[model samples]
Target: MHTKASVQSVADTARGIVLATVEIAARPEHVFRALTEPDQVVRWWGSDEAYRMTNWEMDIGVGGHWRSEGRNADGTSFRASGKLRRVDRPTALSMSWMSDWDGGQASVVHYALEGTTRTTRLTLCHEELVDRPDACRAYAEGWRLVLGWLQQYLAPQSTEAFFLLRLNPPRPNFSEDMSSEEVALMKLHFGYWATLLQAGTAIAYGPVADPGGTWGVAIVRAAEMDAAWVLTDQDPVIRSGRGFRYEIFAMPQLMRGE
Candidate 1:
Protein backbone atom coordinates (compact mmCIF):
# COMPACT_ATOMS: atom_id res chain seq x y z
CA MET A 1 0.00 0.00 0.00
CA HIS A 2 1.24 3.53 -0.81
CA THR A 3 1.63 5.93 2.08
CA LYS A 4 0.19 9.46 2.37
CA ALA A 5 3.67 10.94 2.16
CA SER A 6 4.18 9.28 -1.22
CA VAL A 7 0.88 10.68 -2.47
CA GLN A 8 1.96 14.16 -1.37
CA SER A 9 5.21 13.74 -3.29
CA VAL A 10 3.24 12.90 -6.41
CA ALA A 11 1.18 16.08 -6.00
CA ASP A 12 4.37 18.09 -5.68
CA THR A 13 5.56 16.96 -9.10
CA ALA A 14 2.62 18.47 -11.00
CA ARG A 15 4.58 21.00 -12.95
CA GLY A 16 4.77 21.80 -16.70
CA ILE A 17 4.20 19.33 -19.54
CA VAL A 18 4.98 16.09 -17.79
CA LEU A 19 4.19 12.52 -18.79
CA ALA A 20 3.36 9.98 -16.15
CA THR A 21 2.58 6.24 -16.11
CA VAL A 22 0.73 4.60 -13.23
CA GLU A 23 0.83 1.00 -12.14
CA ILE A 24 -2.59 0.07 -10.82
CA ALA A 25 -3.47 -3.02 -8.84
CA ALA A 26 -6.20 -3.96 -11.30
CA ARG A 27 -6.67 -5.98 -14.48
CA PRO A 28 -6.81 -4.64 -18.04
CA GLU A 29 -10.42 -5.71 -18.47
CA HIS A 30 -11.43 -3.99 -15.25
CA VAL A 31 -9.72 -0.83 -16.36
CA PHE A 32 -11.33 -1.13 -19.76
CA ARG A 33 -14.69 -1.56 -18.09
CA ALA A 34 -14.08 1.58 -16.09
CA LEU A 35 -13.16 3.47 -19.24
CA THR A 36 -16.02 2.36 -21.50
CA GLU A 37 -18.89 1.94 -19.12
CA PRO A 38 -20.88 5.03 -18.12
CA ASP A 39 -21.70 3.96 -14.56
CA GLN A 40 -18.07 3.10 -13.93
CA VAL A 41 -16.81 6.27 -15.58
CA VAL A 42 -19.01 8.37 -13.34
CA ARG A 43 -17.16 6.95 -10.36
CA TRP A 44 -13.70 8.26 -11.35
CA TRP A 45 -13.35 10.51 -14.41
CA GLY A 46 -13.33 14.12 -13.27
CA SER A 47 -11.84 16.63 -10.86
CA ASP A 48 -13.50 18.73 -8.13
CA GLU A 49 -16.91 18.48 -6.47
CA ALA A 50 -17.55 15.09 -8.03
CA TYR A 51 -18.98 16.18 -11.37
CA ARG A 52 -22.16 14.39 -12.27
CA MET A 53 -22.43 12.97 -15.76
CA THR A 54 -25.46 14.46 -17.52
CA ASN A 55 -25.13 12.71 -20.83
CA TRP A 56 -22.78 10.04 -22.11
CA GLU A 57 -22.85 8.31 -25.48
CA MET A 58 -20.28 6.12 -27.15
CA ASP A 59 -20.07 3.79 -30.11
CA ILE A 60 -16.95 1.73 -29.50
CA GLY A 61 -15.52 0.99 -32.91
CA VAL A 62 -13.28 2.47 -35.55
CA GLY A 63 -14.50 5.95 -36.54
CA GLY A 64 -17.15 5.82 -33.83
CA HIS A 65 -18.20 8.84 -31.76
CA TRP A 66 -17.67 9.32 -28.04
CA ARG A 67 -19.31 12.16 -26.19
CA SER A 68 -20.13 13.22 -22.64
CA GLU A 69 -21.27 16.16 -20.53
CA GLY A 70 -20.37 16.78 -16.90
CA ARG A 71 -22.22 18.95 -14.42
CA ASN A 72 -20.16 20.43 -11.62
CA ALA A 73 -21.30 20.92 -8.06
CA ASP A 74 -22.26 24.54 -8.75
CA GLY A 75 -24.17 23.58 -11.91
CA THR A 76 -21.42 24.53 -14.35
CA SER A 77 -21.33 22.16 -17.30
CA PHE A 78 -18.49 20.93 -19.48
CA ARG A 79 -18.80 18.82 -22.60
CA ALA A 80 -16.46 16.90 -24.92
CA SER A 81 -16.58 14.85 -28.08
CA GLY A 82 -14.16 12.84 -30.17
CA LYS A 83 -13.68 10.19 -32.79
CA LEU A 84 -12.61 6.73 -31.73
CA ARG A 85 -9.43 6.11 -33.68
CA ARG A 86 -8.71 2.61 -32.44
CA VAL A 87 -10.02 0.00 -30.04
CA ASP A 88 -8.09 -3.10 -29.09
CA ARG A 89 -9.83 -5.14 -26.47
CA PRO A 90 -8.03 -5.48 -23.11
CA THR A 91 -4.89 -3.85 -24.54
CA ALA A 92 -4.99 -0.54 -26.38
CA LEU A 93 -7.27 2.46 -27.02
CA SER A 94 -6.81 5.62 -29.08
CA MET A 95 -9.18 8.56 -29.23
CA SER A 96 -9.22 12.19 -30.29
CA TRP A 97 -10.00 14.50 -27.35
CA MET A 98 -11.84 17.79 -27.80
CA SER A 99 -13.84 19.99 -25.48
CA ASP A 100 -16.50 22.69 -25.73
CA TRP A 101 -14.68 25.13 -23.44
CA ASP A 102 -12.36 27.97 -24.44
CA GLY A 103 -8.54 27.64 -24.29
CA GLY A 104 -8.99 23.93 -24.83
CA GLN A 105 -6.55 22.24 -27.15
CA ALA A 106 -7.12 19.39 -29.51
CA SER A 107 -5.19 16.26 -28.61
CA VAL A 108 -5.14 12.52 -29.00
CA VAL A 109 -4.99 10.19 -26.03
CA HIS A 110 -3.72 6.64 -25.99
CA TYR A 111 -4.00 3.97 -23.27
CA ALA A 112 -1.94 0.81 -23.14
CA LEU A 113 -1.90 -1.91 -20.51
CA GLU A 114 0.68 -4.52 -19.55
CA GLY A 115 0.01 -7.06 -16.80
CA THR A 116 1.93 -8.36 -13.81
CA THR A 117 1.11 -10.86 -11.09
CA ARG A 118 -1.30 -8.63 -9.16
CA THR A 119 -1.13 -5.36 -11.03
CA THR A 120 -1.37 -3.71 -14.42
CA ARG A 121 0.93 -1.08 -15.89
CA LEU A 122 -1.17 1.63 -17.56
CA THR A 123 0.62 3.76 -20.10
CA LEU A 124 -1.33 6.88 -21.08
CA CYS A 125 -0.06 9.44 -23.55
CA HIS A 126 -1.53 12.74 -24.79
CA GLU A 127 0.04 14.03 -27.96
CA GLU A 128 -0.34 16.50 -30.90
CA LEU A 129 -0.54 19.47 -28.52
CA VAL A 130 2.71 21.21 -29.38
CA ASP A 131 0.79 24.49 -29.79
CA ARG A 132 -1.03 24.28 -26.46
CA PRO A 133 1.56 23.51 -23.83
CA ASP A 134 -0.56 24.66 -20.87
CA ALA A 135 -3.37 22.31 -21.81
CA CYS A 136 -0.87 19.51 -22.05
CA ARG A 137 0.56 20.26 -18.65
CA ALA A 138 -2.84 20.63 -17.08
CA TYR A 139 -3.88 17.35 -18.61
CA ALA A 140 -0.77 15.68 -17.28
CA GLU A 141 -1.63 16.78 -13.78
CA GLY A 142 -5.27 15.96 -14.32
CA TRP A 143 -4.39 12.44 -15.34
CA ARG A 144 -2.27 12.00 -12.26
CA LEU A 145 -5.18 12.94 -10.01
CA VAL A 146 -7.66 10.92 -12.03
CA LEU A 147 -5.57 7.79 -11.79
CA GLY A 148 -5.54 8.03 -8.01
CA TRP A 149 -9.31 8.10 -8.09
CA LEU A 150 -9.39 5.07 -10.37
CA GLN A 151 -7.12 3.04 -8.14
CA GLN A 152 -9.02 3.66 -4.94
CA TYR A 153 -12.44 3.48 -6.53
CA LEU A 154 -11.83 0.02 -7.92
CA ALA A 155 -10.19 -1.55 -4.91
CA PRO A 156 -12.20 -4.67 -4.10
CA GLN A 157 -13.43 -5.57 -0.62
CA SER A 158 -13.83 -9.35 -0.80
CA THR A 159 -11.56 -12.32 -0.38
CA GLU A 160 -10.83 -14.37 -3.52
CA ALA A 161 -9.85 -17.99 -4.17
CA PHE A 162 -7.39 -19.08 -6.85
CA PHE A 163 -7.12 -22.64 -8.16
CA LEU A 164 -4.12 -23.58 -10.27
CA LEU A 165 -4.47 -26.12 -13.08
CA ARG A 166 -2.25 -28.15 -15.41
CA LEU A 167 -3.21 -29.13 -18.94
CA ASN A 168 -1.83 -32.29 -20.46
CA PRO A 169 -1.50 -32.70 -24.19
CA PRO A 170 -3.73 -35.19 -25.98
CA ARG A 171 -2.38 -38.76 -25.82
CA PRO A 172 -4.30 -41.96 -26.19
CA ASN A 173 -2.33 -43.89 -23.55
CA PHE A 174 -1.51 -41.14 -21.06
CA SER A 175 -2.54 -41.28 -17.40
CA GLU A 176 -4.54 -38.64 -15.47
CA ASP A 177 -1.55 -37.11 -13.70
CA MET A 178 0.48 -34.70 -15.81
CA SER A 179 4.15 -34.92 -16.79
CA SER A 180 6.99 -32.46 -16.11
CA GLU A 181 6.19 -30.46 -19.26
CA GLU A 182 2.57 -30.35 -18.16
CA VAL A 183 3.65 -28.83 -14.88
CA ALA A 184 5.46 -26.06 -16.76
CA LEU A 185 2.30 -25.52 -18.78
CA MET A 186 0.44 -24.87 -15.54
CA LYS A 187 2.91 -22.15 -14.72
CA LEU A 188 2.08 -20.52 -18.03
CA HIS A 189 -1.60 -20.71 -17.19
CA PHE A 190 -0.97 -19.06 -13.84
CA GLY A 191 0.91 -16.28 -15.54
CA TYR A 192 -1.95 -15.78 -17.95
CA TRP A 193 -4.51 -15.61 -15.11
CA ALA A 194 -2.35 -13.08 -13.35
CA THR A 195 -2.52 -11.01 -16.50
CA LEU A 196 -6.32 -11.27 -16.51
CA LEU A 197 -6.45 -9.17 -13.33
CA GLN A 198 -5.31 -6.18 -15.38
CA ALA A 199 -8.58 -6.46 -17.26
CA GLY A 200 -10.52 -6.25 -13.96
CA THR A 201 -11.67 -9.86 -13.80
CA ALA A 202 -9.57 -10.13 -10.68
CA ILE A 203 -10.87 -8.80 -7.41
CA ALA A 204 -7.43 -9.12 -5.90
CA TYR A 205 -4.90 -11.77 -6.94
CA GLY A 206 -1.23 -12.54 -6.39
CA PRO A 207 1.11 -15.49 -6.21
CA VAL A 208 2.21 -17.64 -3.30
CA ALA A 209 5.72 -16.30 -2.70
CA ASP A 210 7.15 -19.35 -0.92
CA PRO A 211 7.14 -21.47 -4.09
CA GLY A 212 7.11 -18.53 -6.54
CA GLY A 213 3.61 -19.16 -7.90
CA THR A 214 0.51 -17.00 -8.42
CA TRP A 215 -2.48 -16.97 -6.05
CA GLY A 216 -4.73 -13.97 -5.55
CA VAL A 217 -8.18 -13.12 -4.22
CA ALA A 218 -11.17 -11.32 -5.70
CA ILE A 219 -13.61 -9.50 -3.48
CA VAL A 220 -17.30 -10.16 -3.77
CA ARG A 221 -19.78 -7.94 -1.90
CA ALA A 222 -21.82 -10.96 -0.91
CA ALA A 223 -21.21 -14.63 -0.30
CA GLU A 224 -23.53 -17.60 -0.98
CA MET A 225 -25.10 -15.67 -3.83
CA ASP A 226 -25.14 -15.44 -7.62
CA ALA A 227 -22.53 -12.70 -7.83
CA ALA A 228 -19.89 -14.85 -6.22
CA TRP A 229 -20.85 -17.81 -8.37
CA VAL A 230 -20.60 -15.73 -11.52
CA LEU A 231 -17.14 -14.54 -10.55
CA THR A 232 -15.85 -18.07 -9.98
CA ASP A 233 -17.35 -19.23 -13.23
CA GLN A 234 -15.30 -16.75 -15.26
CA ASP A 235 -12.10 -17.41 -13.36
CA PRO A 236 -9.75 -19.49 -15.48
CA VAL A 237 -8.40 -21.33 -12.47
CA ILE A 238 -11.78 -22.65 -11.33
CA ARG A 239 -13.25 -23.09 -14.82
CA SER A 240 -10.44 -25.14 -16.30
CA GLY A 241 -9.29 -26.99 -13.22
CA ARG A 242 -11.58 -29.98 -12.71
CA GLY A 243 -10.10 -31.13 -9.41
CA PHE A 244 -10.37 -28.29 -6.88
CA ARG A 245 -13.29 -27.73 -4.53
CA TYR A 246 -15.07 -24.40 -3.77
CA GLU A 247 -16.58 -23.83 -0.35
CA ILE A 248 -18.17 -20.58 0.86
CA PHE A 249 -17.91 -19.89 4.56
CA ALA A 250 -18.73 -16.44 5.87
CA MET A 251 -16.17 -14.10 7.33
CA PRO A 252 -17.01 -11.13 9.57
CA GLN A 253 -17.30 -7.70 7.95
CA LEU A 254 -14.45 -6.23 9.95
CA MET A 255 -12.13 -9.07 8.93
CA ARG A 256 -13.30 -8.89 5.28
CA GLY A 257 -11.75 -5.42 4.85
CA GLU A 258 -15.02 -3.56 5.19
Candidate 2:
Protein backbone atom coordinates (compact mmCIF):
# COMPACT_ATOMS: atom_id res chain seq x y z
CA MET A 1 0.00 0.00 0.00
CA HIS A 2 3.05 2.20 0.21
CA THR A 3 1.88 3.26 3.67
CA LYS A 4 5.48 3.12 4.71
CA ALA A 5 7.16 6.45 4.14
CA SER A 6 8.84 6.95 0.81
CA VAL A 7 12.25 8.55 0.39
CA GLN A 8 11.84 11.75 -1.65
CA SER A 9 14.26 14.26 -3.09
CA VAL A 10 13.46 16.99 -0.61
CA ALA A 11 16.15 19.53 -1.35
CA ASP A 12 19.08 19.21 -3.71
CA THR A 13 21.03 22.43 -3.60
CA ALA A 14 23.80 23.38 -6.02
CA ARG A 15 26.64 21.37 -4.43
CA GLY A 16 25.01 19.91 -1.32
CA ILE A 17 21.90 17.77 -1.67
CA VAL A 18 19.31 16.96 0.97
CA LEU A 19 17.77 13.54 0.62
CA ALA A 20 14.11 13.09 1.38
CA THR A 21 13.46 12.55 5.06
CA VAL A 22 12.28 9.11 6.20
CA GLU A 23 9.33 8.76 8.56
CA ILE A 24 9.39 5.77 10.84
CA ALA A 25 6.44 4.55 12.88
CA ALA A 26 8.32 3.52 15.98
CA ARG A 27 8.77 5.73 18.95
CA PRO A 28 11.49 8.33 18.75
CA GLU A 29 13.43 6.69 21.55
CA HIS A 30 13.21 3.29 19.95
CA VAL A 31 14.40 4.56 16.60
CA PHE A 32 17.29 6.32 18.27
CA ARG A 33 18.24 3.14 20.03
CA ALA A 34 18.20 1.20 16.77
CA LEU A 35 20.46 3.83 15.29
CA THR A 36 22.94 3.97 18.18
CA GLU A 37 22.96 0.53 19.67
CA PRO A 38 25.48 -1.88 18.18
CA ASP A 39 23.44 -5.07 18.10
CA GLN A 40 20.28 -3.33 17.05
CA VAL A 41 22.03 -1.54 14.22
CA VAL A 42 23.48 -4.75 12.80
CA ARG A 43 20.13 -6.44 12.84
CA TRP A 44 18.45 -3.84 10.66
CA TRP A 45 21.29 -2.20 8.70
CA GLY A 46 21.82 -4.79 5.97
CA SER A 47 20.13 -6.03 2.80
CA ASP A 48 18.34 -9.37 2.74
CA GLU A 49 20.79 -11.36 0.58
CA ALA A 50 24.46 -10.93 -0.24
CA TYR A 51 24.59 -8.22 2.41
CA ARG A 52 24.94 -8.11 6.19
CA MET A 53 26.48 -6.07 8.97
CA THR A 54 28.95 -7.05 11.68
CA ASN A 55 31.24 -5.50 14.25
CA TRP A 56 29.25 -2.47 15.38
CA GLU A 57 30.31 0.00 18.05
CA MET A 58 28.43 3.11 18.99
CA ASP A 59 28.67 5.74 21.66
CA ILE A 60 25.48 7.73 21.98
CA GLY A 61 26.78 10.93 23.46
CA VAL A 62 28.30 14.04 22.05
CA GLY A 63 31.99 13.79 21.14
CA GLY A 64 31.80 10.02 21.38
CA HIS A 65 33.23 7.73 18.74
CA TRP A 66 31.14 5.47 16.53
CA ARG A 67 32.24 2.77 14.13
CA SER A 68 30.66 0.00 12.12
CA GLU A 69 31.62 -2.44 9.39
CA GLY A 70 29.49 -4.25 6.81
CA ARG A 71 30.29 -7.22 4.59
CA ASN A 72 29.19 -8.15 1.10
CA ALA A 73 28.60 -11.66 -0.17
CA ASP A 74 31.90 -11.55 -2.06
CA GLY A 75 33.85 -11.64 1.24
CA THR A 76 34.96 -8.03 1.19
CA SER A 77 34.35 -5.46 3.94
CA PHE A 78 34.03 -1.71 4.41
CA ARG A 79 34.54 0.34 7.56
CA ALA A 80 33.30 3.72 8.70
CA SER A 81 34.05 5.91 11.69
CA GLY A 82 32.76 9.17 13.04
CA LYS A 83 32.19 11.28 16.11
CA LEU A 84 28.86 12.05 17.73
CA ARG A 85 28.39 15.75 17.29
CA ARG A 86 25.00 16.06 18.89
CA VAL A 87 22.49 14.04 20.87
CA ASP A 88 19.22 15.16 22.41
CA ARG A 89 17.91 12.12 24.14
CA PRO A 90 15.15 10.53 21.98
CA THR A 91 14.48 13.50 19.77
CA ALA A 92 17.59 14.25 17.77
CA LEU A 93 21.13 13.09 16.97
CA SER A 94 23.86 14.33 14.68
CA MET A 95 27.09 12.62 13.74
CA SER A 96 30.03 12.79 11.43
CA TRP A 97 30.19 9.96 8.89
CA MET A 98 33.58 9.02 7.45
CA SER A 99 34.61 5.95 5.53
CA ASP A 100 37.75 4.31 4.14
CA TRP A 101 36.48 4.79 0.57
CA ASP A 102 36.71 8.56 0.91
CA GLY A 103 39.92 8.64 2.92
CA GLY A 104 38.20 10.05 6.02
CA GLN A 105 36.31 13.04 4.71
CA ALA A 106 33.39 13.53 7.10
CA SER A 107 29.72 14.11 6.30
CA VAL A 108 27.14 15.27 8.77
CA VAL A 109 23.89 13.45 9.52
CA HIS A 110 21.07 14.78 11.64
CA TYR A 111 18.13 12.71 12.85
CA ALA A 112 14.92 14.33 14.11
CA LEU A 113 11.67 12.93 15.39
CA GLU A 114 7.96 13.80 15.48
CA GLY A 115 5.19 11.66 16.87
CA THR A 116 1.45 11.15 16.76
CA THR A 117 -0.65 8.86 18.98
CA ARG A 118 0.00 5.68 17.01
CA THR A 119 2.96 6.54 14.80
CA THR A 120 6.26 8.28 15.25
CA ARG A 121 7.97 10.15 12.46
CA LEU A 122 11.72 9.95 12.12
CA THR A 123 13.34 12.53 9.93
CA LEU A 124 16.96 11.99 8.87
CA CYS A 125 18.97 14.74 7.31
CA HIS A 126 22.36 13.79 5.92
CA GLU A 127 24.35 16.66 4.49
CA GLU A 128 27.83 17.73 3.44
CA LEU A 129 28.35 14.73 1.19
CA VAL A 130 31.60 15.42 -0.60
CA ASP A 131 33.90 13.60 -3.00
CA ARG A 132 31.54 10.67 -3.65
CA PRO A 133 28.08 11.29 -4.96
CA ASP A 134 27.78 7.59 -5.66
CA ALA A 135 28.44 6.74 -2.06
CA CYS A 136 25.90 9.28 -0.92
CA ARG A 137 23.22 7.91 -3.22
CA ALA A 138 24.01 4.38 -2.11
CA TYR A 139 23.64 5.36 1.50
CA ALA A 140 20.36 7.12 0.80
CA GLU A 141 19.06 4.02 -0.86
CA GLY A 142 20.32 1.96 2.03
CA TRP A 143 18.29 4.01 4.46
CA ARG A 144 15.07 3.35 2.54
CA LEU A 145 15.80 -0.37 2.30
CA VAL A 146 16.70 -0.69 5.95
CA LEU A 147 13.55 1.02 7.15
CA GLY A 148 11.53 -1.92 5.89
CA TRP A 149 14.13 -4.34 7.16
CA LEU A 150 13.91 -2.71 10.54
CA GLN A 151 10.19 -3.32 10.73
CA GLN A 152 10.72 -6.98 9.95
CA TYR A 153 13.62 -7.18 12.37
CA LEU A 154 11.49 -5.79 15.15
CA ALA A 155 8.62 -8.14 14.41
CA PRO A 156 7.93 -11.17 16.56
CA GLN A 157 8.95 -13.73 13.96
CA SER A 158 11.92 -15.88 14.84
CA THR A 159 14.92 -16.47 12.60
CA GLU A 160 13.82 -19.16 10.12
CA ALA A 161 17.15 -21.01 10.31
CA PHE A 162 20.57 -20.71 11.82
CA PHE A 163 23.81 -22.66 11.27
CA LEU A 164 27.45 -22.28 12.03
CA LEU A 165 30.44 -22.82 9.70
CA ARG A 166 33.34 -23.95 11.80
CA LEU A 167 36.69 -23.12 10.29
CA ASN A 168 38.14 -26.10 8.42
CA PRO A 169 41.09 -27.06 6.20
CA PRO A 170 44.31 -25.07 5.76
CA ARG A 171 45.61 -23.51 8.96
CA PRO A 172 46.24 -19.78 9.35
CA ASN A 173 49.72 -18.46 8.74
CA PHE A 174 51.49 -16.39 11.35
CA SER A 175 55.02 -15.38 12.15
CA GLU A 176 56.50 -13.60 15.13
CA ASP A 177 58.75 -11.66 12.76
CA MET A 178 56.66 -10.97 9.68
CA SER A 179 58.53 -10.18 6.48
CA SER A 180 57.80 -6.98 4.58
CA GLU A 181 56.21 -9.03 1.83
CA GLU A 182 54.01 -10.82 4.33
CA VAL A 183 52.95 -7.53 5.90
CA ALA A 184 52.00 -6.12 2.52
CA LEU A 185 50.05 -9.24 1.64
CA MET A 186 48.17 -9.16 4.92
CA LYS A 187 47.26 -5.51 4.32
CA LEU A 188 45.89 -6.42 0.93
CA HIS A 189 43.78 -9.16 2.48
CA PHE A 190 42.42 -6.84 5.15
CA GLY A 191 41.67 -4.19 2.58
CA TYR A 192 39.60 -6.65 0.56
CA TRP A 193 37.60 -7.65 3.60
CA ALA A 194 36.92 -4.00 4.35
CA THR A 195 35.53 -3.45 0.88
CA LEU A 196 33.10 -6.34 1.23
CA LEU A 197 31.96 -5.10 4.58
CA GLN A 198 30.95 -1.77 3.08
CA ALA A 199 28.93 -3.52 0.41
CA GLY A 200 27.01 -5.46 3.15
CA THR A 201 27.70 -9.19 2.65
CA ALA A 202 30.02 -10.05 5.52
CA ILE A 203 28.32 -11.63 8.53
CA ALA A 204 31.00 -11.90 11.17
CA TYR A 205 34.83 -11.68 11.22
CA GLY A 206 37.79 -11.13 13.50
CA PRO A 207 41.59 -11.36 13.50
CA VAL A 208 42.00 -13.17 16.81
CA ALA A 209 41.83 -10.12 19.01
CA ASP A 210 42.73 -12.25 22.02
CA PRO A 211 46.32 -12.16 23.15
CA GLY A 212 46.86 -15.93 22.88
CA GLY A 213 45.01 -17.07 19.78
CA THR A 214 46.87 -19.08 17.14
CA TRP A 215 44.73 -17.93 14.18
CA GLY A 216 41.99 -15.59 13.07
CA VAL A 217 38.55 -16.85 12.12
CA ALA A 218 35.50 -15.47 10.33
CA ILE A 219 31.95 -16.85 10.19
CA VAL A 220 29.76 -15.98 7.25
CA ARG A 221 26.05 -16.64 6.68
CA ALA A 222 24.85 -16.74 3.10
CA ALA A 223 21.99 -17.95 0.93
CA GLU A 224 23.93 -21.14 0.30
CA MET A 225 27.27 -22.71 0.99
CA ASP A 226 27.90 -22.66 -2.74
CA ALA A 227 27.72 -18.91 -2.62
CA ALA A 228 29.91 -18.83 0.44
CA TRP A 229 32.34 -21.15 -1.26
CA VAL A 230 32.55 -18.83 -4.23
CA LEU A 231 33.66 -16.12 -1.83
CA THR A 232 36.35 -18.05 0.01
CA ASP A 233 37.00 -21.01 -2.30
CA GLN A 234 39.55 -19.26 -4.46
CA ASP A 235 42.10 -17.30 -2.52
CA PRO A 236 45.71 -16.39 -3.10
CA VAL A 237 46.21 -17.32 0.52
CA ILE A 238 44.60 -20.75 0.20
CA ARG A 239 45.50 -21.81 -3.36
CA SER A 240 49.12 -20.68 -3.83
CA GLY A 241 48.23 -20.00 -7.53
CA ARG A 242 47.12 -23.54 -8.52
CA GLY A 243 43.53 -22.64 -7.43
CA PHE A 244 41.25 -23.69 -4.57
CA ARG A 245 41.05 -27.27 -3.41
CA TYR A 246 38.89 -29.14 -0.88
CA GLU A 247 35.31 -30.40 -1.05
CA ILE A 248 32.79 -28.09 0.58
CA PHE A 249 30.73 -29.69 3.29
CA ALA A 250 27.22 -30.50 2.11
CA MET A 251 24.33 -29.01 4.10
CA PRO A 252 21.35 -28.36 1.90
CA GLN A 253 18.84 -27.93 4.70
CA LEU A 254 20.74 -25.06 6.22
CA MET A 255 20.71 -23.16 2.96
CA ARG A 256 17.20 -24.17 1.96
CA GLY A 257 15.54 -23.16 5.23
CA GLU A 258 13.77 -26.49 5.41
Expressed as tens digits, the lDDT of each residue in 1-258 for candidate 1 is 332211111121232233557766566766776677665577467656656666777888989999989887788899988989999977888898888763445678788878753466777776776656556666666677766666654443334322222222233222346677556655664675566666654444443332333333433343222233345445554555644323222233424356
Candidate 2 RMSD computed on C-alpha atoms after optimal superposition onto the true structure: 15.7
**How do the residues 1-258 of candidate 2 rate in per-residue lDDT, one tens digit apiece?**
225555443444444545646555445655666677775677567874756888789877899999988887777888988999999987888888888756777788787777653345767777887555775776666666666565544321222212233332233335355568656655665566566567756545546544443344545445433344445543444444322133223232434333
lDDT computed for candidate 2: 0.59
lDDT of each: 0.57, 0.59
Model 2: residues with Cα > 4 Å off, grouped in runs: 1-3, 9-13, 130-132, 154-258
- How much is the lDDT of residue 118 in candidate 2? 37
Candidate 2 TM-score versus the reference? 0.54
The numbered model that scores best in TM-score is 1
